[model samples]
Target: MIADARRAVVRAGVAIGIGMGGFVDGILFHQILQIHNMLSARIPPDTLVGAKVNMVWDGVFHAFVWGVTALGVALLWRARGGSARVPGRMFGGALLLGWGSFNLIEGVIDHHLLALHHVVERLGPSVWDWVFLVSGVALAATGWMLTRQIDS
Candidate 1:
């Protein structure tokens, strides 16, 4: 039996948050809105072949995210038989923290560093990237606050 232990199964929640957040970003911003793709800034989807390539890369990205979400689900299932009581706030906080972390890390790595993609390709490297990062920060802060009180 896995004990909730000192961490309160935060890892599970965080993983879930990360997966969900990434999906929203990828689906909403990337696909639904048709704003940007994984390699939009690099290869671009201007040509038919380019669009196909971007679509493939986008699928790859989603696959990875799906794996992340599956991991989170596994963690939660294990925690169900644990010794400690998982707090609602703790879960939520961890979730937000995970989302924020995703935005911050992804934004910095892909947008700023590697130049794999931009927050909004049409807008170029403008306030969109900063906004993405800032939103992540806000989510993280909120999660931090929520997790302060140990429900257990």
Candidate 2:
């Protein structure tokens, strides 16, 4: 049986991982690399207005990620009071799982289903999108294995 504290720690790690993943996507892909935006598919970022619109949406996405990260921080703080020990491996696995989950869900919804954006807007639904999804599944599987090992 898993301890309540362990569960709490895992949850917190996952949440923080998700938030961190989002920040990486936003900062690296959206801002630094200048690849794609939240609504780059529908609103091309060629003009000033289009760029501003995408920026606003990006801000919204960041805000949501921040909230998730804050929630994780609170959970971690709360779990610290518990007597049960949380293995470091468990926390690390949880983070990987969370990041992978984010990639899978976001890639499917934004890049495929809704067509909100792609990994590379210039490519227009190329192999890079598939690679993203595959990498996410790989990360999630590895994380799951690590967590299961620690749990057992």
Best by TM-score: 2
Off by over 4 Å in 1: 1-8, 82-85
lDDT of 1 by residue, 1-78 (tens): 123442546788889889988899899988899999999999989999999999999999899888999999898777
Model 2 alpha-carbon miss at residue 100, Å: 0.3
RMSD of 2: 1.9
Q: What is the C-alpha local distance difference test score of each model? A: 0.84, 0.85
Candidate 1, lDDT over the whole model: 0.84
RMSD of each: 2.4, 1.9
Candidate 2 deviant stretches above 4 angstroms? 82-85
